[model samples]
Target: MTRRTTLNLPQLRAFLAVVDAGGFSAAAAELGMSQSAVSHAVASLERELAAPLLIRAHPVRTTVLGERVLPHARMALSAVRSVEQLAAEATGTMTGTVRLAATPTVCQGLVPGLLRHWREDQPLVTVRVFEGDSSEVSAWLEDGTADAAVLIDPPPATAGSYPHPGVQLATDGYRALLPRDHPLAEEPAIDLRDLEDDPFLISPNGCEARVRTIHRLAGLRFSPTHRVRDLATLISMVQAGIGVTVLSEVSRSLIPADLVLLPLKPDTSRRLVLTGPQNRLWHPALRTLADSAAGHLAHTASCTAGPAVGQPLPSRSG
Candidate 1:
């Protein structure tokens, strides 16, 4: 007696077509084969598996056995397509998710607008945002939880410190946020000395280190009337006449209707940086997000605080 051979590619392909097309005739049309040929393939597949692979009703449907095999078949097809894509992308193609971390301020002010613009340009890439303080963001990068981060205060400038292999991105300086009615509002820019005696609002502990540095540099101390965790809340306090706060120009939009933003005096600035691991593969989505963030930061410098005020302030970046 001759032994029957295992299922062949043609049989599997035809079965898949029938399952997708919902009928043998339709599958035959799609596969450019005769209906009988298509049916023969399905029969062969079923015989090899020793189980019915389809239920023949008015509209044919997959049997339990067919359903079980369908997923594996689909996954196999997907893997083939992915391999082809990778081959095509050998020259260059950006796809997949880019996990990004940022302080609350960067997340609220920079990321939203940037993502809006980036979606139009690179629709294939998805950017997942993680919000935390600078320290937390650093930790996330170190732990492989995020692909990159928008850091406000990077590590100190020393060998193996600033611009570490773990961080590869641009940086920017800080700006000042004040009430529109405040005295400093009239100046095109003001120095830290200009803010003397003003009621100050500071961010939470880890993230506030930069604010502390700013004060220390100017040889002044601000008794913050309010300490908040998020940029929106901190800006709210500034709007309520609670006090003034210094923030990145990227977060200038967070100012309330009652507030205004001014460039810092003597040009004290925080580094707005994009950082990612040295060994991590670069995703097109992440590059788009970072570029969008940079562009939005430029436009946001002139933004006036609008109705977004009094809303629950967004989270802050570390």
Candidate 2:
């Protein structure tokens, strides 16, 4: 079988230093080690290199193969040390900009408050935010465009192979938005069949695809006549009587005064997960920000206090 790993540079260098100084005792004196210690280093190096590094019979002669590998081993050792030096400088100091990608709903609703909460602890770490859909957020994480990300778990049909298994921070549910004067707007919850023939306005941004999927899975028909990309625009279309739409609790704060938000019957929901590069360690500030959002923001993103998904609309008075 082939030796599966490249040579360990430090061990190879120790073996070379022993070879240069002739005998193990003399090499130890020159390299600042005990003779037995120098001998053990060479033994370990030979095992990994899969080649005899020294002939132990006399004044430590390099084996024929060891002489052939000396130059390459020295260069590899030099390159490894250089990388170690640079990494030592960057590993823990959390002072630079950290980039993150998020969906528009998170970008507008959750991110601002998360920044404020994180800033008190990480005053020096400047966070830059970018907006995208769930797929874009996960892609940014895989490609190194983002240091971390906040995204909805993609709908099963559209999910991609993400680098890291996400840490779910929250679950947001869907709601139906209607103009305050819509005939059935005061209902506690909306049955999909109630609006089976009503004109639908699909929210192209946020979790629009999710709403569509829920309708499909429920075996209901949702023929949207108008499509829009902004939450405010999605609401405006409903307000102007263009059509009705479905939104999630994350977007509840953006709803207008004239709109009635009630839970979507047989409620559909999605988990919000935090994603980032799998192998890299997060800087101190970045980890703190991620932790804060995961620990605190998850609970607060829902519109629990209002007459939205969790409660019934007020009764209309004469």
Candidate 3:
């Protein structure tokens, strides 16, 4: 007779919680377990796997092995949940996890409300949001770390394809964000030339494509005085009078009370795209989420100033 060892579901659960929460302490709080117990579970798992899983960096970086194992673990968990669902089919309950990634701006301005709505509608489904810049979000989807992503100016499908394929969640035009007292704030609308010499705050290098397009269309070089990664940070800097920045109508919700959003001349626009693996069918809960996001954005656009100051841009619908 051959000896066999059973899999430790509790230990695996603890490890996944730590990865999702970004640290042992947070994982413990989320799982309602003692921090020491969480740590011990992870230690036991590491001993079993014979590999160090996570790096002790702030924000809890995952090691290469951890990254490789993460997707498999998620899949295994999903399978287990599916079995439970089969057993509970007569009860007509839905439960699973959906992982989504997006730019910090979208995460802050649009996703929170959508997630809240999702929780109300699908009480059993867990939604996890990951925030990063455009490139990082795209990479997350490609690598299976995220099930889907919301992206602006998705890299051209080819070198020059406009409005790349996949599903479009929404469309928004650009605007100039200015401090309330700035000279250009009183202008009913703004021309690109008016911003030529203005000190500008802009998205970091990874998000330069659309910004570059605007600059190119305006026939000016984008010489931003400050480049930041998060839209909220850029808006805060603008509110503090550091510099004016260009923003999308969708970003209007993030504008501070002291800032004003003026429409840009020539009507430059961007598309928000929801992307995932081409062939995989989305879970019903995720489909509900995407539909809700699209509906909310449509409702917001039709009823509001489109990009009024102090309001976040809607994430879906034109």
Candidate 4:
């Protein structure tokens, strides 16, 4: 006959905690259980294994066998946590943190609006935001550092694309930002080639990628005389007549009063995208984020300046 024993989750956790905490009493306090309960759990685990897992002494410590099993126990606990999270996501009873990553502009321009709406809907889901450059944002999703992201679309669909599910959130076009007294400021629509000689400024969060893409689309040589990474600083520089750059209309709220935003002759626009891991159902909170962002964009589409882009330029009189 073979001896068999089934170990419970409580037994495994108690055993690991007692070994780590160096005592039953400490593990009990950490687990919110009585010391006797903690001791019983560990004893149950030991009986299941048919081995002496710990040595009771002035200061409790694990035995050699316990040391060997500890790593496996930890891995099991981690797997259990993953299962629990997936189940929670599936049931839409999302609680705890939903980690998010986004480009700097999205962090300022879109994330806040989405989160504000999310707060009203899913108050139990805590969202944590991490701001990065475009590539960094993608890396966070792939590396499991983030549960979701707000990004510009169309995503890099080439080989080595972000391995995840994605959706478009909103559609908005770009416009040029210049000082009110700039030479071509009076033009109703400005061609990309019109400002060839002017010094260009790349706006907050290293919007160099968008600048490069615009140059490619327009078949023009593009170079920024200065790169500005802070939104407020970029606005101040433009207001001071430092240089000109393109901005998404959704970002109009961040624009200062002294600058002028003009439509582009050949319009260029972007669709905001939301993405999550491909391996599992997006954490319920992440799904909510995508839905909330889409709904917010739709709700704000008919009117300018509610949440995302789609705003008509403000008059110079203001």
Candidate 5:
């Protein structure tokens, strides 16, 4: 009798977890397994396949075989989730882990509140957030690493693309950040061109393109004195009077008391939306989250105290 080669979800998940987390130890921690157990799983998988999948190193690197196997592993896992989702849908109880991707800003500014609502609305659903730049978030969605994502100013779907439209979560215009003592800090609102003479600090954190567009619209060059990657670093540079910068008004919550946030004249804004996979059927929890977000935003819109989605920002003193 010939022996049958076998693969199981645990083995596949172990392989993927090591590749994604960059090491067996980290992957074990993520999966709540012992490091040796995770290693054993991968080794067993390699034995079953009769090939090496990963190079053992400080940070594990996938062998060619592993690279080839990754997509199939992801697909297998995604299919299992789909089956679970379908069952949950039929039973009228949403339950599963949703891998949600978001840009750093959205993760910091918006996701906590959104997660709170999800926790209450669907108690059985668990959301695991992956925070990255816009490009990384989009790529994760494409590769099936994430079931849903919070997209920033995503372009309109072309013909024959994903049928379900993205649900808008929030809209926020750009605001200029300056040292309290800067010359333009006292103005109610400053024109974009007015800051052309000063050194500009910008973060390439998923908003650089929009900032360039705003500069182009204002008839100024989009050159930056420094391109900072971290939001905290960018805010620090402005606070130290190194340069001024613009950020989404949603970032107001993250700004310190010392940095002055002023409105920009001839304003440009970005729309944040909850979106799901374009090529595959969405996990039912994702659709529920989108609907819940729409209703939550609508409810928030009626309240007077805070900013609302799709509305002009409330005025603030300089």
Candidate 6:
């Protein structure tokens, strides 16, 4: 007979928390438990499985076996939550928490507006936002840390296409960000070659891939004087006349008043879509949020400052 040992939810939670928070102390703070308790829980789990899960070091990371186990843990937890949500639905009270993930720009630019809309439309549902880089955001959705997420440029139909149902929230193109008094700022549209002489900055937070492609298509070297991770830092550097960068037009709201954003000579656009989980059943609130998003876009279509959702644009790389 095979040995049977029941897995504990708290232990699994402790393990996941440590990995996500980056350390035992941080995980303890996040889970409202002592550091020793968190560590003990993980140790108990490791002993039960007869395998080590994490490397004990600064900013602790998962071992190879832990990586294989994490997705199963996430799915198990999500399934439990779904059962609880079903019970609540039977009571006629439509209320639950949703974890939504997004890149830094989407969190700052689009999430606030969606949350505002949800407040009025689905008052009982609470949304928690997890801000991460694009890759992290995608992984979170797949692993159930995020019930839904905003994906950039998801493929239409292929093996690599998004696996879940999604709705396109907005379609916007890239624009060059420059100081208001800069020489190129006077022009209606700036060509990539014209700015080659100036110091160019690239934000690797999520936009670097598209920026590299833009340079390659323009037949120019993709060298940047600086590679910054924080959008605010990049904006500050550009505002101080240190350099210039390109960003999505959706982020116009976050731009300072002294900066001017102009379209490129040849437009490059990307689609932003809100999608549910890929490997787990959708949380009840996930569908509600998607519906609310669709309604919000339809109502705001007439007066939205950015490009309309799903509108066609010029042929260019996303």
Candidate 5 worst ten-residue window by lDDT = 309-318
Q: Tens digits of per-residue lDDT for model 4 on 144-193? A: 55668776664443334323345566575788889888889899988888
Model 2 lDDT, residue 158, Cα: 17
How do the candidates rank by TM-score, highest first? 5, 6, 3, 4, 2, 1
Model 6 alpha-carbon miss at residue 194, Å? 3.0
Off by over 4 Å in 2: 1-93, 154-167, 279-284, 295-318
Candidate 2 worst ten-residue window by lDDT: 309-318
Best by lDDT: 5
Model 1 / residue 207 / CA error / Å: 4.6
Q: lDDT values of the candidates?
A: 0.66, 0.67, 0.71, 0.72, 0.84, 0.82
Q: What TM-score does prediction 5 earn? A: 0.89
Give each model a TM-score: 0.56, 0.59, 0.73, 0.63, 0.89, 0.78
In candidate 4, stretches whose alpha carbon ends up further than 4 angstroms from where it belongs are 1-82, 85-92, 154-165, 203-205, 279-281, 299-318
Best by TM-score: 5
Point out where model 6 deviates above 4 Å.
Answer: 1-3, 8-15, 23-68, 85-92, 157-164, 302-318
> What is model 1's C-alpha RMSD?
14.0
Of 3 and 6, which scores higher on TM-score? 6
RMSD of each: 14.0, 17.9, 5.9, 10.8, 5.5, 5.0
Worst 10 residues of 4 by lDDT: 309-318
Q: How do the residues 13-32 of candidate 5 rate in per-residue lDDT, one tens digit apiece?
A: 89988987789988898788
lDDT of 2 at 204: 61
| Per-residue C-alpha lDDT of model 2 across residues 119-179, encoded as one tens digit per residue | 8756766887878877788876655456688767633321233222445555678888888
Model 3 misplaced regions, further than 4 Å: 1-5, 8-10, 50-68, 78-92, 154-169, 228-233, 240-242, 274-284, 294-318
**TM-score of candidate 4 on Cα atoms, chains taken together:** 0.63
Per-residue lDDT for 11 in model 2?
A: 73
Clash list (residue pairs), candidate 3: 250-313, 252-311, 253-311, 253-312
